[model samples]
Each structure stands twice: as structure tokens, then as C-alpha cells.
Target: MVSKHTLLSNDLFGDLNPKDWPISLADLPPGSALVGGSVRDGLLNKLSQKPDLDFVIPIEAIKFSKNLSKRINATFIKLDKKRDIARLVINGWTLDFARQVGKNLEDDLLRRDFRINAIALKLSKKPEIFDPIGGMDDLKNKKIVAISEKNLIDDPLRILRGFRLMCELDFELEKKTQIFLKNNVDKLSNVAPERIKMEILKIAHSNWNSSVWPTYLELQLLKKWNEDKLPNLELKRKDIFSTKPIAGVFLAKLICLLSDEGLSSLKFSKNEIKRCKNLRFWVRKINNLGLDNFSEDERFQLHVDLEEDLPSLILFLNDKYANVWLKRWEDPSDPLFHPSSPLSGHSLQKALEIRSGPFLGELMRHLSKEKAYRRFFTNHEALEVARKWTLENSPFL
Candidate 1:
């Protein structure tokens, strides 16, 4: 089998000098020889006949191929094509590109959004590191610096991306970058809620949950949203610099803290609002229970109640007391607080031998409640009780 890297080299560089192709392009998959075209042919002739030719020239292809090159060592082979493009595939990365375009890797690196991501490695011609944006310095300093100011302005989503990086990379925002973020926090409002929600979820799921609230506050981004109705939401810049807290727990707490504000300002979808509301409810429930009265069953129930709201629950309950409950609740071996209903409407319908209707639904609910409260050992026992109750109470039965 041809080595994946060798194939990629042939695909990207072919007979061309390795120095000319961008370092990032070294990883693309090999392209098939285009028997018809010449290197001197115009871009239209090369591209018009083969759409893949254009794709090979794009930065996306280089990035994609480079990632592929890392996985497999493919051989590079020269092709006698009219255009300076070649094709090869290695571990799923393939592209056809002009050798000349490959040489100017610096221009390609500059197009990236952040300095950190702009760093690239050349695989061929005495492999070397390329950093057109000084990303290495930023990385060393633990900084989340943008590639260009305009990069953030052109796409407001970068603001959230920056926040995400801060959380993921454990990097601090540069002072100037922070000021720029504060000035443009409003631009986030223009971004789609789905995009914003994705970033928020990522942060909430990360170890940087605590950082998120404070960072948003510093930018006054949280205040700009109609979260004024949430209690204890005082925005203090110092909060961001505080010790990092558990991500999930902080998220739940944040939602509860912002419950009154309604998720509308954040542009959360209906489903997202429901999830947030459930999270808030769980947080409030946990808070109300306090540390003293929490029982194994209660803790289990807390987990069940939270359901998908688990992340939020974790966020809200960060106190020492809450931590105790979390330890118990997080134990998968422990029985769930409230197991799913043992009795269903169908059970009621079958037990009653009655047509499916509201009556069966009502009976099922009553039976479920009894089973929950009484802690029936089995579904059969619950059904027996439901039968007796139905026989005595149902006019139709």
C-alpha cells in the first residue's frame, strides 16, 4: 500500500518544489493527473473542467489535507499534468493544487481567526514551523488574541469563540482585546441564538463555567441582555478573575440567577427556554432543601427531577452542602430517586378492559402517584391496586 503521506505529497506537490507550496498544503491527498490541462492554462480552463481543482486551491482543502497527512504516511509522486495541480489521498485527505499557491503558506495562515490557530507545520522540504501571526508567542503567554480586529468585527460570533477559547485553553484575554470585546458585546445580539447557545453550552460543559459569567459581566454583555430580572446578578468585573468553579454547577446557578430576566434577551429557543426553566427549578429545589434535610432518596429524586437539567443542577449547587448532594446523586450505582412510573395508561386500559380514553389516563396517574408514594415492589402489585381502585371507583367499569 502506498504510504498516506507519500500519496498526499504527490497529490499536493507532485513534481513541484516543496518550498513553493504552503506548509499547510503538504498534508492534502494526492490528485489524479489531468491529462488535458497545462500549467500555463488559465484558472478558468483548469477549474471549469474540474471543480476539485478550485477546492485544492482553497485554504479549507489545505487545512483538511494537513490533518489527514498527520494520520498516514503517504508517498508523493509527480504527475505530468498541464496544470500545476496533482491529486492523492491519504487517510481520507485528498486535494489537487497548484504548486505556486502552496509556497506562500504565510498568506494562508493570516486568514485564520486567531493567532493560536494560525500556527502550521511544514511536513516536507526540511519540515519547519510557520507562524505568520506570532501565534506561538501568544500561545506561550496564555493569551487569546485575535488575528485581526476586523476578524472579530466582521463576524461577531468570534466574540463568543474567544470566550470559548478562554475556557478551553485556560487562557486570559489580553487587556486591549478585553476592551475591544466590551465595546462590541452588543454585536452578539446580532448573531443567531443557536450559535450563541452552542457556545454557552460548551462553556457550561467546560471547567470554565465560573469564568463565563464573570467574563460576560466584564464585557457588560450579560447586562445588555434583559437579564435584569434575575436576582443577585450584580455584575462585578472581579468575578471573572476568581478561582475557577465547576462548569455544570455554575451554569445551573447562573440560570437561576437570571430566571426573572427570561431567556428572550439571550434569544434562546423555546426548547432552550424549557431546559433553562427546568434547570432553574432544580436549582431552587436544591437550595430549598438545604444541606441538613437531604436524604439519599431526595438526592436521587433531585437527579431525576433535573434530568437533562443535570448540567444546570450541577451549576447551581456549588456550595459545600450542595457538593455533598452532588456526590451522592452523581453515583450511578445508587438507585434513582424517582424511577419512571411503574404503571402506564395501557396497563390501566387493559386492567379495566375499557376503551382508551381520559378515564384510563386519570386512573394511570392516580396509580403512578400511589406507586411512587407507597414504593410498590413490582408493576404487578401496582396493577393489582389499580384494578381494585378502578373496580370500586369507575362507573363504566
Candidate 2:
């Protein structure tokens, strides 16, 4: 039986219902409670952007997690079996499960990494707010303070996590917390590379205009994390974070700005590394060619290479490069820059008597380049142009 505590109203938490949650009142383990993010976000009025919900139960966390995962038809992933931490993921739903580290809510909250993340509400019909570490007050103050020094020592990942939270919530880290973060920066090296990569990517993908690099630099975390790949703090550009959340191209740009070797150490995916390398290649090519020297075909190829990334790339470059891109596309509807190709593979095959194979693909690329360079206006004209080009280029013709 659950009691309805009006103060801990489920209504305030937009998506935090028993049906939507990992476990319902009937299935909730004894002494299980809704803790951390879900409760904090509800009070903070960040219902929409909250990522995942957290729950703590006294023992049986893994068994309960597996059972709840079965109930919700979610994927049960054991985060730390020894520590009794598990995760359930199903579509948009994510719930983290952990056993209470101490005897009660106070002890659990005290053992948490930060005060702003320690508040909780019991899992009952009659729920009540249980905040023992002044988390509510710290949250209201927009302050991020560690629960205790031992907490940071216990998990060095919290140092990185604290900076991430500061960026996410735009909060100020307490002075003592800052000292502790700086001192234990070395422990971050002991953290799993994948864990470190995830945090870095989160910082990139966030709407936080502020750079975590600054925080990392302050704590020497950046130097420690960099090892040798990002040797120069001045050159390891951190301005890639912006009001615009990091999407594909932006993320690639960030990776390029940060050294390839640094990303390798952090264990970014092969695809991510490849994209970043391509982006760097494009940047170098653009610099070497200059705005005026780049032919229309060359510029078009650059745009195609950087797909869905023109505006961002244009903005990120120096004044000269940015101006060149702006000048190139001043007429947004310019025929030379139009995405539609005037010729098709089938059209070329029929007109040029070319078989549908490697030759056809080559013609398509050729015609597409001509289209960007404004060599032909219509499909018929493009076919004629292709016919001439094939006669000149083909050995047997």
C-alpha cells in the first residue's frame, strides 16, 4: 500500500508515474525509494530535459532490477554487481537501480556525490520528501557541493561528473568541492576510458555554452586526460561547445580541434574518429585552396563532404574563410550550388549507350560535378556533355 503525500506529488513530475516507471507500487521492493535525478528535476522544474530516473532500494537491487526489466520489457544491464547497481532501458525510459549504501535515506544522501543530487521521495502512495544533506537548499542556491570529501575519494569519476553537472545546470561549484576535484584529478586516469569518453561526449552534446575544458584545465584534469595528444592548452580548442547542441558535424569539428590521439585515448568510436579526420582534411584543403582559388566544382565537393554542416562550418572558420563561404552562397538559390543533379545514371546510360556498371557511376559523378560548376542547365544538355566527356575519356570509345 502506498500513501499519497501531497508534498511529493507525482503530478509535479510529468512522466514519473507508476505505470511509466520501472516498477509500480505493487512491484516496488520494500523500502525502495525514488531518489536523485527524478526528484531533483521535478523540484527544479526541468521535467522535459531530464535524462533518466534513479531509484535506491535497501539490498536486492540486481534481482529487483532484473524483475522490473522483465515487467517493463526493458533491457536489464548490470552496472556494478558487487555494489548492487543496475540499469533498465526501454525506448525513452531509463531507470538506474542501486542499493542503499547506508541504513537510511540520510546515510544514502550523505554518501552521494553532490548535495544538489541527493534529494529523494519515498516510493509509496503517501510519499514524503527526504532530504538530509540540505540538497534542496543547495539546489535552490544553484550551488554544487560535494556531500563530503570521502565521497570524491571513493569515486574520482565524480570530479568529471561535477564539471558536467555544472555545465548542464549552469551552477557554481562550491570552493571546497573545487579543491577536492583538483586534488583527486589523478584518480580520473583510473576510471574506464569508455566512461571518460561518455562524459566528454555528453559535454559536447549538451546545450551548455560553457566549456568543461576550463574546469578541466583548472583542476589539471585536462592535462592528465590529454597525456600527450593534447599537449598545448592554448591549441586544444574548447570553443566548439555552443548554444547549438553538438550534432554530427559539430561533434566532428570538436574532435578535429582536439587532437586525434587524445580522442583515441578517450576511446571514441572508429566512426567518430573517421568523421573527425575527414572534417580536419576538409578544413586543411579549404585553407590551402583559399576562397577565390577554389573552383565551383571544388567548393561544391567540399559542401557535399561536410553534409548538413555548411552553416556551422562557415561560422566556425576565420573571418576570411567565413566571408568566402558567405560570398559563395550569398545567392542561396544559385543554380551552381543547387543540390539537385540535372543528370541521372539511367539517363546517362540511355544517352551515352553506356552499360549500368562502374562506367555509369563514373558518368554520374562527372555530370554531378558539371552540374555544380553550372556547365549544363537541363538533363538533355547534361547527357550531351556526358556523351562528349565519355568519348574523350573512354579508351575503347
Provide the global lDDT of candidate 2 against the true structure.
Answer: 0.70
lDDT of 1 by residue, 175-276 (tens): 777777777887887887767767766664555433555776677554444443333322232233245433345445347324434466556677767666
Give the alpha-carbon lDDT of every model: 0.53, 0.70
Q: In model 1, where do residues sit more than 4 Å from their true spots?
A: 1-112, 192-194, 222-270, 282-305, 318-324, 327-336, 378-381, 388-397
lDDT of candidate 1 vs native? 0.53
Candidate 2 clash pair list: 2-125, 3-125, 3-126, 4-125, 4-126
C-alpha TM-scores of all predictions:
0.59, 0.80
What 10-residue stretch in candidate 2 is worst by lDDT? 228-237
Model 2, TM vs. native: 0.80
Error of 1 at 365 (Å): 3.6
